[model samples]
Target: MPKAKKKNRRKKYNYNVDRKKLNRAFRKRQAPRIKCSQIRHAWDRTKSVSQNLAEMGLAADPNKAVPIPKFMQPVMKMDIDGPEKKSKIVQKPYVLNELEYQASLPEKQSQTLSRDLIDYVQHMIQNHGENYKAMARDEKNYYQDTPKQIKSKINVYKRIYPEEYQAFCTSLQQEKMDKQ
Candidate 1:
């Protein structure tokens, strides 16, 4: 059998290839030729970055350019003082006193009862003489502008008929007064 042919090393075959220039050309090809202004217009019209990119004639797979929002934290422009270092961010404990929390929050006024209506309801509850529930139901059905007009009228009826509301304080007062 013939001996295996040795690989011929030729000086003419050696040539200097500039990797930097080749890499630069490759990067240029990868970059879009579209103008920045056109891209901006597309973004402005769509009101979104990815949506604008989609219309800008770039072959973009949304899955590639940007990851799913759920998997990613919001991008924040944090200045790096040194080399990239990550520290666990601990959330501050929510310490709230009952009074503080209540004070901080908005106050909720009674829906149907005004200050006058509340007094009227108390009076009706105290007397313990009539069916205020029916009257209340009627007022609720008939009256419109609450906390101002209708609310007061409804309370007056409640004063005449306390049983309608099932208000416990009214029942106790009626017993205390020997009206029950």
Candidate 2:
């Protein structure tokens, strides 16, 4: 065979580019006609939705809220009534479901209620039996949630269980943080 033609070396191709200029090209191009302030104002109108976006890790925008120092706010305080009285007077101490308590309220009377206390009373009647059996059940759950047993539970812990509620809150906060 005739001498093979000398192999030609492949020429190296280069795509050298300036990073800054490339980045500028890739960056989001703003509609020059749209004013930045007007865009910001439009975003402000969606404050709640935007806040949720940050919560969902969809945005880096800082929250527009003042941080309340932990010390500034008192630990939670639950206004617990006496065990017996609480059963008779408060929302069912052993409420199995929060939704059910809400559902039990009369469609209209629940609305007429001017304050939370009235709404609570309505909840109590449903959770605790309206009669003696209900009262007994109420007493049982009240004691379960607290230390004092039965009527004593009611009489001894007549004040709101601010400490107990606070403890529960701390536990919940810790649990949430752990989940995070």
Candidate 3:
């Protein structure tokens, strides 16, 4: 049997260098160059460094460069006898009193549940006792919570208000005794 002839699939490569086209392409891709003299001329002695940079279309933080006034600059003091003498006075560290420290601190925020949620928990407990499944199926269970979720809420209520929970249990017991 005769073998089939394979077709040439190689791409044609250009070896010629076009200097004019290369230079034009490079110029188009390059950023606009700024001379040192241009920058010096654009800068204002009265204005801040950031302001000058911003006016020249450069990214600079407004607060980064703060210009100090001539009067605010510290003057070099010369001693007649020798070099500059340092001040002997030492500053004492400030100490806050207990009451003052307490007053300065932020007040604690309440993280307890809302009055409505607390009431709902109390209602559920009164109606269903320890039966979380019954609580979950209750008519007042508007959230349609699972038995596990109902039990968790009840546990939270008991943990948060131990005294109130104890009082509630005693009241239920008293009612049961009265019935008997």
Question: Relative to the true structure, how large is the alpha-carbon lDDT of every model?
Answer: 0.50, 0.43, 0.72
- Write model 3 residue lDDT over 1-180, tens digit each, in one string: 766556455666666978789898898576344445456655566777565665555436644345455685568855588767453221211212333566699987455877888899999988889899899899999999999998899898888788888998899889889989
Ranking of predictions according to TM-score: 3, 1, 2
Off by over 4 Å in 3: 1-92, 95-109
> What clash pairs does model 3 have?
none
Residue runs of model 2 more than 4 Å from their true location after superposition: 1-15, 30-36, 41-49, 52-180
Pairs that collide in candidate 1 are 124-159, 125-170, 132-164, 133-164
lDDT (Cα, tens digit) per residue for candidate 1, span 1-180: 766566454456325888789898997797545454434333443245444444443424757545565746567857678687554232211212332465699876444546665555555444433455544544433443433344466555556546656566555766778953
Q: How well does candidate 1 match the true structure in TM-score terms?
A: 0.21
Worst 10 residues of 1 by lDDT: 90-99
Candidate 2 residue 2 Cα shift, in angstroms, is: 30
Point out the higher-scoring one by TM-score: 1 or 2. 1
Best by TM-score: 3
lDDT of candidate 3? Answer: 0.72
For 1-180, candidate 2 gives per-residue lDDT tens digits of: 766565566766556968778666665352123243323333423357545333333333444333345675667856577465322232222332333566697775222223453333334433452343455556434434322233343332223344543564476667679989
